[model samples]
Target: MKTLKQLLADKPKTLAVAAPDDSVFQALCVMAEYNVGALLVLQDGKLVGIFSERDYARKQIRNQRSSKETPVRDLMSARVAYVGIDATLEECMSLMTEKRFRHLPVLDDQGQVLGILSIGDLVKETISAQQFLIGELERYITS
Candidate 1:
């Protein structure tokens, strides 16, 4: 029943971003610097799309497109899956699984981007919750 807000609070507050018109190479460099697999494509401070390592491999590398010439808008995934702060972890996980996405941008009610969530983040939270539940059950049974 944990919410996306709770999960985000546990993570380091950093969101790597790139301009939509930025070169794919520039975006990739930012990703490398941040040690993140994806970068949010922002245009005029709005969330426009997402560029990930997968996109680079599929759109640029596979097509042999020059990274410096390719724009993030052309290579980024435009159909982004967004998760609200109020959304449950289960909801986020289900959406990600159904969509086959490794990253989800966290949004607020006002459609403002807050943070990004990765499949790894969801998995870690699920495991922690399961452990807490198991511990509670064991204590209850022993008592």
Candidate 2:
């Protein structure tokens, strides 16, 4: 099984983050700039929450809240479900499926944010692994 650490190592080492007190508009701008669907909400380098497009659409826009006026902390998901670097892709997929959320912040032993994972990332990895295994099996069968 591939661990999150391996997946993260293969990805670009960039973390899109926002301060909890930052405006929702600011968080959205950062997300757009990074070309990501979500941003980790950090306070003093610690994971405090997460802000995503879903949060913006559900918590802010639906409620007629102004993104420019509202702080990210106000709409961000505070009860963040995170995973350690050693967590397997299957574990992440299970958790995400059960929770009905897409993003999960990866943490280190000290609870420092290492990176974030999305459902798309896990699915792609899983598909690649399966393809490789199938290729190997075919080669073995033909040998």
* Poorest stretch of ten by lDDT in candidate 2: 58-67
Q: Which regions of candidate 1 fall more than 4 Å away from where they truly are?
A: 62-64
Question: After TM-score superposition, what is the CA distance of residue 115 in candidate 2 from its true location, in Å?
Answer: 0.6
lDDT of 2 by residue, 45-81 (tens): 8999999999988888565668888999999999999
lDDT of 1: 0.88
Q: Write the per-residue lDDT of candidate 1 for residues 75-127, one digit (tens) a residue.
A: 89998989778888888889989999899999888888999999999998889
TM-score of each: 0.93, 0.95
- Lowest-sum lDDT 10-residue window in model 1: 57-66
Superposed on all Cα atoms, the candidates' RMSDs to the truth, in angstroms, are 1.4, 1.2
